[model samples]
Target: MSADVAIIGAGYTGLSTARYLAASGVEPVVIEASRIGWGASGRNGGVVSGKFRIGFAEMARRWDLETARRMHDLGIEAIDHVGETIEELGIKGADYRPTGSLRCAHNQVALDALRAEADWLTGTLGDQAISMLGPEEMKAETGSRDFPGGMLNRHGGVIHPLNYVLGMARALAGQGIRIYCETPVTRLGRTADGIELHTDRGVVRARQVVIATNGYSDLTPATDAVRRRLIPFRSAMIATELLDRPMLEHDRSYTETRRMMRWFRKAGGRLVYGGRGAFGKADSAAAFAALEKAMRRQFPQLAGVAVTHRWSGLVGMTMDSLPHLSRLDDRVTFSLGYNGTGVALASMIGRHAARMVLGQKTDAGLLTSEALRPVPFYEIREPAVRLVAGYYQFLDAIGR
Candidate 1:
């Protein structure tokens, strides 16, 4: 098989790349190991978090203030881009909701920090969409008294993740883009003309290749270096039975400020809660019980609520806690490491990668410009991740 461009992984990023490439009159072949949206793209909490893993102050401390501000603004734009694409394309069955999101603080100290961050975002960054919510306001908005305070971003919201990606896949299929499910690329090598991707069925030769396999990079040998730079972590979620009303007052999605943060939202009359999972395990009965215990602590009213579904997915975590996009060679481009904020950001980055493949300049700014260094002693990343997870839990316990 031969094509102008080839995309591996049919998750949000890969499908988004294919969509834009097709729009540019380039029919790209997309290969997926499983079905479309079978990874984190479909298994996430469905929150369109218009923010990054690192906060604005941390971003400023690491980089400059101006660069930090621009990156934050770019995240907001990425959220808008997703909403625009869904609306413009008339993508149906996505359950797209612009209900916004709330970042809750676990304690008074965290609340004070949240207030300061809100001021910085509104005053310095001129982000009028974000506002601080005190305890009363937060309780009124979220229907939970566990949070001391929170910040609300009017631009952030939620969607049916599986439906969203599947909708994009259907639309791309209508445009004559070849989508081969259950077709995994085992190796990626450079050919004299361009690049060659060897799969179980056959080899696909394309002038340019986009590696969209974010958390599942271990599936492709071409991304070994990239894989070492990313620490794959499992995140698990449980969906409760349909409730009487929305779990949140305004149906707003929410996340706490802890290292092992809890993200939850009301969707389809069910309360969906999720967080980081145990090291080296995808889904387990113990993990689900722990998550349910956390949920009960947060919302005691649902102590006996029935959990209808439990699921888990891998998330690619970068060393610096930021997403990385780069062009490895003239014929190879890739984007990954979303740090759990991939629903919207991945789509935007995928488009940028597509532009890069077409030899067009993209405005990725510091994201693509920053070098992605591999984790130290990455060969033992599994045990290292376990240690890191324990450290985070310890910090959370002491409230440091």
Candidate 2:
């Protein structure tokens, strides 16, 4: 088969790329290794976080003020794009709700930093989408007195992750976009005239290709470039059995501001809480134990709640903590690395990549300004991450 464009991995990034490309009168085909929404896009905390791993102050410090502001706009645009798509496409099963989100500070120092961030957004960037919650308000917002304060973004919400991606696949199909499920692209070859993708079923040739595999980049032999550029870490989550009452006052998404973080929300009348897992383990016994322990530490009242489900997924982390499009070759482009905050970013990055592929104007500040460098100590990243993660956990424990 031959086409103008072929996208790899039918996750949020891939589907978003196809959807936007088709909207522009360009037909694109998507190839997935497994069923649709098989990656992190399908299984996440479901928080619509338009946030970056790097904060506004730090981004400005690293670059310039204008660049930081542009990145800020891009984050907001990402979450907005998701909300608009759900409504515009009329996807009912997505379970989207603009309940807003709270970023809890486990310590007073963290609370102050959160306030400073809010000030920068409002005072510097003129972004008032977020509000600062004091001690009293934090308790009310989080339903826990343990939190000192938080920053609330009404734009951030929750969704049924799997359903969102599936709905997107259906919408793309409605637009004549072909999605080949369980058809893995085994090999990628660069042709003199175009690119060739050797899949399990057949070979496909295209003028250009976008790699949207994200955390699953290493699974495909053709994604060697993407694999080295990303640091894949495991994230585990658990869901409590049906609760007799609501979890929180507002029951929106809640995330703690820390190095080794905990994020959770209420979905399907269950408390879905998640956190970082050891890089060496899978989604079973050992991994879920850490998650349940952390969840219980936060909400010990739920210790008696039965855990109905547990799972793990790889989260691709970038060196810069910014989502980017690296065009190593004109015919090949790679888009990945949301740094674990991709619930809303998946579509946003996809749109940016699609526009760049179309040669249209895109507001990609530092995202495309440079190519991604290889993660340090790539040869032994698992043990390396363990060392770093242990340090971060210590800092977070001491309230640093």
Candidate 3:
């Protein structure tokens, strides 16, 4: 084999896996369809969240409470792992901040639910810094009175996502990990000895192959089992061309929620806000208008903030909301489907993939504890998701 392992996609998962492989004395080759950070890793909301309890109950039921908690802790550990890497690698371009995150409740019902969630998180997750804020407190904290109350998680934060991915690529490439940009893997099949990665540029025969293509799952040949287990969804974001002094002084960008969830941060004189992208191509005037309207509702001071850029990326959603990390064959393995929290979870998953490839096994409850059950009647998932997502946008316009 030319290389011990070949990882497709130079996004967060692929870059992290390459780094891990290098550290473990295995040099892997990475292929990117476009430039580095071209996928969802470069685009999505740049928030590090510990609230990925999506299907928390189901995961607990299947893996036991202890394993579930450990898995949850691994998500938190992923953030720390990224932070440690940033510091160790001396990556300074990515404007990393630990200012924490605020989850706003726009209505009484949402506020009540947030309060309960805060209490539950505090008690069960050993998280205490989560504090509930009233309307006045929310106003004071965010310089907006749009939300009645919210919960602040001090452990969470945000970063310049594109820069972070690029830094990771540089770090891994410096370690002699072969990273090929503008190279797309067309197919992956069984070879005589191991796995073969067929690409547009060349074929890479490796002893092991890691499918780090999270959002671009369709790029790979999905067997019938996988075809039924995962689906791709798109997310969109827009940024204003830096707010004026009044808005800047009055507000510090914070993640907030009403009918639809939004993640935002004030950087480079612009307010970057992101949420579920509308159906179809990313460039939607309606989506940009929706974002602008939401921003105005939150901060009325900046009603005419000009939008500078708008973009979108696909995210892989698994049937159970948890990812599946299993060996498809003898020498091939994959870990994907972040469900929308890949920014914080991909690093840890990549680390685990490294361990899996090295045959150094641990608890392994992070990815495989839950069963890979497809969503019942998932054939209608795409169109149904589009309809529901559009409805949310319409409903959010009315602040419902």
Better of 1 and 3 by lDDT: 1
lDDT of 3 by residue, 179-248 (tens): 9998777777776787777776778888998877776766546333455567777777888886775443
Q: Which stretches of candidate 2 lie over 4 Å from their true place?
A: none
What is the descending lDDT order? 1, 2, 3
Which pairs of residues clash in candidate 2, taking residues 3 or more apart in a chain or in different chains?
A: none
lDDT of 2 by residue, 125-216 (tens): 88877798888987766567889889887877888999998998998788789999999898999899999999879999998899999889
Question: For each candidate, how many residue pairs have backbone atoms clashing (under 3 Å)?
Answer: 0, 0, 1
> Residue 58 CA error for candidate 2 (Å)?
1.1
Ranking by TM-score: 1, 2, 3
Clashing pairs in 1: none
Writing each residue's lDDT as its tens digit, candidate 1 over 1-400 gives 8999999899999988998898888879999999999988988888987688888877888888988888887888898888887886678988888888888998888889889899988888888998888889988877778888898889878899998988888888887889999988888888789889898899999999998998988876866767888888999999999896545768778889898898899888899999977678456788889999899888888866799999899999999888888887788888998988899998777678888889998877577878777889988889988887889989988887
Each candidate structure's TM-score, on Cα atoms with residue i matched to residue i, is: 0.97, 0.96, 0.90
lDDT winner among the candidates?
A: 1
lDDT-better candidate, 2 vs 3: 2
